[model samples]
Target chain A: MQSLIVDLGERSYPIYIGQNILCEALIKPFIKGNQVMVVTNDTIAPLYLDHLLAHLSGLSVDVTVLPDGESYKDLTHLNLIFDNLLKNKHNRTTTLIALGGGVVGDMTGFAAASYQRGVDFIQIPTTVLSQVDSSVGGKTGVNHPLGKNMIGAFYQPQLVVADISVFATLPDRELSAGIAEVIKYGLIYDYSFFCWLEENIERLVARDADILMQAIHRSCEIKAEVVAQDEKEAGIRAWLNLGHTFGHAIETHQGYGNWLHGEAVAAGTMMALSLSVQMGWISIEDMDRVRRLFEKANLPVTPPKNMSSNDFIDLMSVDKKVLNGQLRLVLLKTLGEAVVTADYSKEKLMDVLSA
Target chain B: MQSLIVDLGERSYPIYIGQNILCEALIKPFIKGNQVMVVTNDTIAPLYLDHLLAHLSGLSVDVTVLPDGESYKDLTHLNLIFDNLLKNKHNRTTTLIALGGGVVGDMTGFAAASYQRGVDFIQIPTTVLSQVDSSVGGKTGVNHPLGKNMIGAFYQPQLVVADISVFATLPDRELSAGIAEVIKYGLIYDYSFFCWLEENIERLVARDADILMQAIHRSCEIKAEVVAQDEKEAGIRAWLNLGHTFGHAIETHQGYGNWLHGEAVAAGTMMALSLSVQMGWISIEDMDRVRRLFEKANLPVTPPKNMSSNDFIDLMSVDKKVLNGQLRLVLLKTLGEAVVTADYSKEKLMDVLSA
Candidate 1:
């Protein structure tokens, strides 16, 4: 087992990565209060709720199992967590445990942030997608029908326990979805990690324990550093959304849960990379290198066939990335470097979208 | 005009208290973005919305007029703020201006807090209840059916423009409700202020402009000092909620809008003072002093005749003040001092409730 701390002053917490740390006593110290409410989903509840609860043994524990999928990640379902907490008499001192993937973690973290103003919560991510991305960042919120992640808070968790052993149960498509974010860390921030991902993509796909652990650790380290510097996404942190502007449009257009977040991000990242090539910032060969990595990971390298430039424009306008009336996007400046800019030409953007 | 700052480090903001300050350039400096959305209720919209919008002529401004009242201060109605924001393509750079009473302020502050994970917001509090209490502290949220303020955030506004001129149009009942909180600041922290309220209670009820301004300024000064020391209510800040635990129970029991928040708080404050008297912490004369002031302000000094001790206990258990299984109550050690304690005897609490 290895741990990395996300340094956020008083809000700083550690992310623990290991084979089966979920059953370990590592989470005991982080439970600030005697009362614990574990928020999971129907899919993960049947699989790991009891196991997680078993580890939470002497504390007064309650469970709220929401229906699975991003479609359920809305205010209506977010209320269910509040309902369960209040119904069971969970108070300001109670700690909420988010015991599933991103949706559960996001909702539960948000639930913790808003419950009686704010409360403590632990994240035990059960999928590769969550373990690599959502679990590390302090970003927690539910979706609005108008946009993805449209309503949320920058709330950090008490502790994040990412037991990769749970990923053995993740479907192949989901595994590739997780790798999409893994590839993102490389394309946006680190060239060496990008090369390493290129070399070890197959082993990660097969779920090799050590390789998967390395990938998760590296992704979190980069994310933790970015978050520590710019927790609220005011400046440099926007680089982390290399494909998210385009990706959110795809997710909102297709309706949430229809296209997995990382899958949409994968296609969105491709559009960003293509735009980068057209701008002459990076060569076609360099963009192709990142494209090959996404393709090898079995992720979508393009937007949906039916989605048009108009759809992308309309949906992307409402994205959180838009400042004033300008649509700013995270575009690659070169391999291993990214910049958020609204300076790009519209005709060129339209050309890339039409392509 | 008088201005004071709520010193919350980087999140600190100024509170401008004066007559008709809402129409001044005081608000423009606080707006961090070019887009603005003014969230007001029906009652206040017809009164002050256009006047507030006139000051924001150059910016892209939109208005969302919600039904007025505390009953509408819930998650369902909170969605309307988001719907209007998204429909108008308001992005992260948008600043939300809450232009009404506490209900509108709480919802707008929370909407600003949760919109795109947070945005800049300014408060133009028209009601005395909001100008003195909710506007000073960064406490923002909506209510749930099961509880009042069950869903919310501790999000501060960029600026608070408390235009006392608007109170001239307020009803007699609403005027008394605002006095309840003004009386609270005195009871919990300032014996001199309490004495002041006692002597000038009738003048305040008559809505004397100078006297109300003095009361609001003093109340905000005390609140700002307390909030600066403890922003999240971990310790000294809970004293600011001197009557809130019992007050929230009364509000929840009366079904939100049925009881104005300050009126319920007035009654709840009496209950706390009564319990304090029973505990031998204060003399009967001291508690009576407060009771008389509530009476003079046309506020209730006791719980509803139908509400039983069991109702108080059942509702208070879910309060944000409850820690673990313990029901902590804020009691006065004397006229100007308050302490949050779970050390009281249950029988004494029952005595106060049954009375």
Candidate 2:
């Protein structure tokens, strides 16, 4: 097992990675009290909720399996968890275990943050996407009608348990979804990791343990180093959102659940690369490479057919990166290197966007 | 104006106390952004919202007055603020001004904290209760069905504008409610302040600005000291909740909005004193003095009718203060000092609890 610390001082926590870390004794020390609430979703509920439940057995535990979708990640669903915790008499000391992918982790982290003005929560991320991305960052919230993650807190979890074994049962579509985000780590900040993912795409799809584990670990190392430096996403951290501004617009425009988040982000990354080329920061050859690498992973490379270009731009204006009036984009200047800037003009953006 | 700084580093804020600060240029320099949302209630909206709106006419602003009452201090109310903010296309940089009592301040502050992962907010407290307590602590949240202030954060405002002139039109019952929290400042951590309140209780009720402002400044100083030591309520901060444990039970049991929160706290403070004497922490003469003070302020001194002892105890269990299995209580050792301990026999607690 490999233990990585987030280094947030008093709020700092650990992310344990390995095949059997879930059953390992390292985590029991952080469990704060007797009551525990396991928050997962229907898609992930039938698979590994029982494995987590068996481990939580002599301790008082309650499990809530919400409907599986991004649309459900709103006030109604958050309230369901709140209702269960309160009805079951969970207190501030009660620990919450988020036992699924990004949606489950985000919602659970937020519910934990808001429940009783905050409580302790451990992340038991079951999907590759969560293991590599969402579990590492302290960002937590659901999408709103006006924007995605427009309401949330920068609340860190006490522990993140990335159990690789749980990903074995992910559906082809979901597994592919996780691969998109995995490729994102390479595309934005590491040309070498990009080259590595380019070479190992098939093995990862085949679920080769060594390659998959390395991808998870390296991605986490890169992310943890970035997050440790900028916990509040004030400056350098915004670079991590390479495809998210476009990703959020696509997801909101596509009506949340119609496309998985990472799938939208996959297509969004293509758009970001295209814009990077239009802005003269990167070569067209590099954009083609990003598209080809995504294709090899079976990821979507085009925007969803339903959303209007006008609507997409409007949605992007509300992105967290758009702090002032202008929208900021995290674009790639080269493989393994990214830049956060809003210097592109309307004409250039619209020309590239019309594609 | 009484300038008290609640120091929490980056989250630190200043609470300003005086009459006509809102209409004067005194509060203008602290106002940061152009876009502002004024959150108020029907009772306070009619009384003070116009004055606030008039003062804010030079800036880009909107006013939303929610249904009047403590019951309105919930997620639904918070959602209303979000809905309006989003509908107005107010970006994360917009400032939110809470222009009522504790209910308005709490919900607006929380809305600021969670809306787009936080925005700037200023406290324009119109009520005497808010000017002294809620405005300074940086504690913001709505009530849950299970308990009060159970879901909140320690989010500070940029500046607090307390206009004493707004209190001239305040109702007698509401004015008395404010006195209850005023008396609390003396009870928990300041015996001299307690003695002072005892001597000048009638003067404070008569709207003596010198005494009222003194009471506000001293209360803020004691609260500021406790919050500075433990901003997150990990220890010392909970002492500020001396009467709130039982106070919340009374508010929750009486069907919220039935009795003013300060009035409920007034009665609960007496109960805490009665138990303190029973536990040999204070003299019987102290309880007598507390009773006399509440009477002079025209505040309730008994648990409201129809609330059972069992209901109060059950309610306290879900409080943010009860860590693990212990029901932590902050009791006065003397008028000027307090102690927090869970060391009490169930039988002993039952005697005072069952009354």
Per TM-score, the best of the predicted structures is 1
Query: B1-355 in candidate 2: lDDT tens per residue?
Result: 6787888888888877876767636556666666788888888887777777777767878888899788888887788888888777777778898988889999999888888888888898878889888988788998878778766676889988877888888888988998888788788788889889988988999999988888888888888888899987888787777788888889889888998989988888888888888888889987898898999999999997787889988888877777776888878788767778888656877887888
lDDT of 2 at A115: 85
**Each candidate's lDDT (Cα)?**
0.90, 0.84
What are the per-residue Cα lDDT tens digits for candidate 1 across B163-236? 79998789989989999999999988999999999999989999888999999999999999999999988898
What TM-score does each of the candidates earn? 0.99, 0.97
User: How close is candidate 1 at the interface, in terms of C-alpha RMSD after superposing the true interface residues?
Assistant: 0.9
Clashing pairs in 2: A189-A336, A190-A336, A191-A336, B191-B335, B191-B336
lDDT of 1: 0.90
The CAPRI classification for model 1 reads as high
Instruction: Tell me, by DockQ, which candidate is best.
Output: 1
- Where model 1 places Cα greater than 4 Å from the true spot, the runs are none
